[model samples]
Target chain A: MITFLFYLPFILGFVVIGVWGERKIASFIQDRYGPMEVGPKGLLQTIADLLKMLQKEDIRPKAADKPLFLMAPLLIFVAIFAGFAVLPISPAISGADIETGVFFLLAVVSLDVVGVLMAGWGSNNKYSLYGAMRSVAQIVSYEIPLGITVLCMVVIGSTLDLNELSSLQGIFTSETTYLFGIKSLGIDVTQIGGILSWNIVQVPFSFLIFLIFFIAGLAEANRAPFDLPESESELIGGYHTEYAGFRWGIFMLSEYAMMLLVSFLASILFFGGWNTPFPNIGSVTMATWTSGTPGELSGAIWGAFWLIFKTTIFVFVQMWVRWTYPRLRVDQLMSLSWKYLTPAALILLLLCGVWKMLMV
Target chain B: MDQMAVYLFYFFGLLAIAGALGILITRNLMHAAFLLIAVFLSVAAIFVLGGAEFVAVSQIMVYVGGILILLIFGIMLTNRISSDKIDTGFGNVLLGILVGCAFLVWVGDYILTQFNDQKAALEQTNNQTEKLGISLIADHVLAFELIAILLLIALIGAAYIAKKDKEEVME
Candidate 1:
């Protein structure tokens, strides 16, 4: 409960920053200035927008189901917030350090779909319904590949605990003991930990797994070009079409929060959660800084700092892709997952299984 | 911890019953689908209280997340929003209520009678996932393999059903 309270504000604060960063990145991609007046480089633009949303009149469609309509956004918010409960910002800072952390994370994150469906249904709008349906298909289809990739990581890591995964990628001393003699491959020159100890680098076929996972993560988060669910040219505003004011803001908040959550998971699984990429080569105490010692305040602080740093990079990439690519058609989106990603993930899973056997 | 578990069981048990009642009484089919989600979630809570965390998460992921979304799709895609009522008719409704009551009473009686006599030991292991994985690979390998094949066949059948026929394409 204490961990949840600590992360609640931390997550909200990050969401605000993420909103501003997304706009700035979108503008930068299109060669324009994004929200420069609200604060320095429009830093406070999200705050201004939040106030504006609060002041706007909350409107409900006459035909809408009143209770479900009112509850939809709150449900979405809660689903994302619940997902945060399992995510470890630092080794010592997590809401629930349950053994089924990964499974629980995936389960809670998938709950967002229910909220989206409810929003679309309760709104009683055709476009909203269409958007919801598309979203359901996309999320469900992409989830298989996303899950496979996560399983790939889990198989390599040999643990489902997020905190343990983080510790396994420590700056100086990582979990090379379980590398199944793959550490003798000579690619990992510096045994004294760094990027080489990261899952994407250490685990066999992990590069491909990371690629597939990243793309699937993008789809699951409904980021463009896979944003068929809400493609403005086609579906108006998608499931949140009938939503307005703070209700609409809640949807936006959930979207960004989901994006961050996926990005953080990617970082935690692949890029080394809260572990500095630099090795302990000098007298700089990089090991001390990156280590997740439970009682050490510096370790906790730096651990969180690195985690946020890696997660931010992934979020930026997502934003860049969102602005750079044109949205995919629904058919193309379906084919991309079923035809390409699913087969690729399956093959990769098989190959990784073989690789693990060899290492063992 | 035992007290907490007992309280949680009562809470989720009531929640599950309430969800079932909601499903029965709700006029809207969409609302009933949502209520089914509630029932699924409460059942998952029960599984968690029993220390089957993997089963609880799987229940949520597969039933609540995956299958419930499909149910919602079925409801929405059929354009049944405005006409969401499930017409059981007067006689059928009474029969359904009577059957439901009788079934509940029988189950309650059975549980009450067997509760003390069948006080099975709780799981001593914390690593249920590892145990589950091992059993699936070792003792339950054949059943697991058969289930995999069955799922594959089901997938193929679904694809066959969904695909356009050659005659339709020619037309």
Candidate 2:
């Protein structure tokens, strides 16, 4: 509950930063000033937008389904927020700490499809319906590869618990960690504890798996080149076209929050959540200094620092990809998921299974 | 914790029943679909209250996420005979009620007979997912494999049918 409360404000703050950051990044990539007026570097632009949104009249179409129209935004926000309850911030600080944390997170987050459907159908608008349908279809299709990649990690780790998964990739692991799961090589990366211990490094194939995961995560978060659902040129705001004021703000907030969630998951699964990238190179002892022992206050602080740091990097990459690439057509999007990523992910899953067997 | 579980059970159970009733009573097809999601969710909650977290999550993922979305998509794409509501014309009312009553009675009797045994088994179970996995692989491997093959066949058949339909449209 405490973690949940903490995340609520964190998400809100992240949205304020994320919106401004996205605009600035987009501008910089295009060689233009982003937001310069509001609060030095336009930091207060999102805040100003929020205040303006709050005061705007909540408009509803006369033909709209009143109950569903009113409930859709709340449902979308709540469903997305519920996913954070299972995500561990650090070794010492986590939300639910459930054994089925990863599975539960995936399940809860997918409920937003229902909310999106509600928003589209209840609005009784053609564009909103088209947006909702396209969004739901994209998410559902992308989830196949996304789930397969995550399953690849789960196969290698032999655990679904995110905290356990995180611990296994760092100095805190209780089991012996062989470099690339090859014992005959006679190299153990565990004690060295840095990039060597991270999942992508320990299991070399996981880098490919992580790439697939990253692409799938981008699609799942509705970021371009997969943001066809909200293609402003055609759909004009898509599912939230009928939505106005704070309701529309809620949709934007959830989109940014989803981006952050995916970044956190990517870092946690591949880059080693809350674990320092610096190795303890003999007398240097940088890894130990950076990532304090689990359960200590210093541990929590360092853990949060590294996790947030890694997450921010991934978030920036997501923004970079969004601005760099053009939006994919609907057919192109579906083909990428079903034809390309799905096959690649399935092969990775098989390879991961074999790798797990070899490690055993 | 035990008391809380009991309260949660009652809360979700009532919610499930209410949602089911709403689905039956609702005039709009979309409303009925949404009500069905509520029922599915509450039933998943009941699964959680029973200490079956894995099952609960799977229930939500497969039913609410996969199946319900497809169901809603179908509802949205279909041309409605009416403007707002999909008219549900009733037929064979007496036979429908009789069959429903008989099934309810049979299920109620079965649950009554097995309740105590199931409760005892549930209490003894811990780390249900691990145990479930072991049993599925070691004890019921044949059944699991058979189900997987069945689903694969069904998927292929559906794909073939869809492809044929598209080819027909193209011609």
Candidate 3:
């Protein structure tokens, strides 16, 4: 119950601002003014939209499967929100610090596909079915590269615990590198905690893995460029064609929530999650910016701050990518995942393993 | 907590059984697919209750993620054969139900005979996944390697079949 209470406000606030940010950024990219009416700089526009969605009539198709149709959005919401249970915002402020946190997160998130399929099939619409079919294929295909790329990180860290993975990338602390026991690479080149200590920088070809993961994450979340599942140009609302009012709102909310989940995982896996980018300077205190002191309220605050900050950056990048790239054809999307990304990720996984064995 | 565990186990057990029944009764193939998810989720919960977090997660990932999606795809491709309903003759349905029930009773009798109430204590380990990983490479290496080899062959076979169909289309 406490977890639900905490997540309610967090997700609400994130979706509200994330929607606004996406629009504002989209308009900025096109050199047009975005929503400027509702609140200052159109900040309250999402709230107004939310109210409008709530008040609208909940319409159902006459031929649609009512139970599955109604339950799809709720199931998707539950599955996506359950992922938050294992994601550690701060050392002190996590939901559930399970041993299989990473695997559990992947498992819960994958359940969203079932909801998408349900929505697609229950609508009794051809467009909805096509959307659902595409979504399942896209999501299932991308999950391989996504899981293997995550395995790359797991192999490097030797742990599935998200918190442990995060702590392993502590700023400025160099991972011990053993060069065949002949002589240790004595110099601590990556001693400074920051981007340098991050797995993206620390491991060989990890930057490449990070990029593949990001691309796969975008496809998995059904974002634009891989948004064939909901390609508005082709299929009127994709799997959610028949949904209306609050149900549609829930779908959109879950989409953004999925975006946030992917970004959060990316930050945790590659970037120094909850760890400040600023390195410690002599006699200068920037302690508050880094990971918070565990068990301290101050620590949770900073931990939340850094984690959210890094996540927002990634979300912004996702929005940027969304507007920038044209949506891939369905064949192209499948080929990208299977032909390129899978093999690339496989090689990267092997490279990381070798790097760990030989260098560290 | 122990009582809660017992109740939770019963809850999931009933859910699993209910899901299986739903699958058996549902005429709609898609509905059965969805019901199968409930069975998978309940089984995963049972695994979690048994202190096998890794197994529980892998259960969700593999069964829910890979297998269910493939099953749905299979159903979709066979839509022309039967889209709305999968009708069976009444006599056949009754026969199928009777056979299913007989099998269930046999399984129950076996469980009753073989089950042990004196279970081993839960291991005090923070990271069961680490132990699992080590064992997979150590004691279970052959089985693991064989599974990998099987999957590789299956992948190759699938690719070859798909490619042949594409070539036929082109010709």
- CA RMSD, predictions in order: 2.4, 1.7, 2.6
Poorest 10 consecutive residues of model 3 chain B by lDDT?
Answer: B81-90
C-alpha lDDT (0 to 100) for residue B50 of candidate 3: 83
Listed in order, the DockQ scores are 0.66, 0.60, 0.66
Candidate closer to the true structure by TM-score (higher is better), 1 or 2: 2
Question: What are the lDDT figures for the candidates, one per model?
Answer: 0.82, 0.87, 0.84
- The superposed Cα distance between candidate 3 and the true structure at residue B159, in angstroms, equals 0.8
How would you encode candidate 3's per-residue C-alpha lDDT over A1-360 as one tens digit per residue? 435776668888989999999999999999998999999999999999999899999999988888899999999989998888877777656568688888899989999999999998899888999999999999999999999999999998888888778866764233542222112555453435555556777774778999999999999899989999899889988999999999999999899989999999999999868767775455553543565567798777887888889999999999999999999998999999999999999998888888778766
Clashes of 1: 0
* Pairs of residues at least 3 apart in sequence or in different chains that clash in candidate 2: none
True contacts kept of 2: 0.66
Question: Which one wins by DockQ: 2 or 3?
Answer: 3
Ranking, lDDT, top scorer first: 2, 3, 1
Off by over 4 Å in 2: B80-83, B164-171
By summed lDDT, which 10 consecutive residues of candidate 3 chain A come out lowest? A174-183
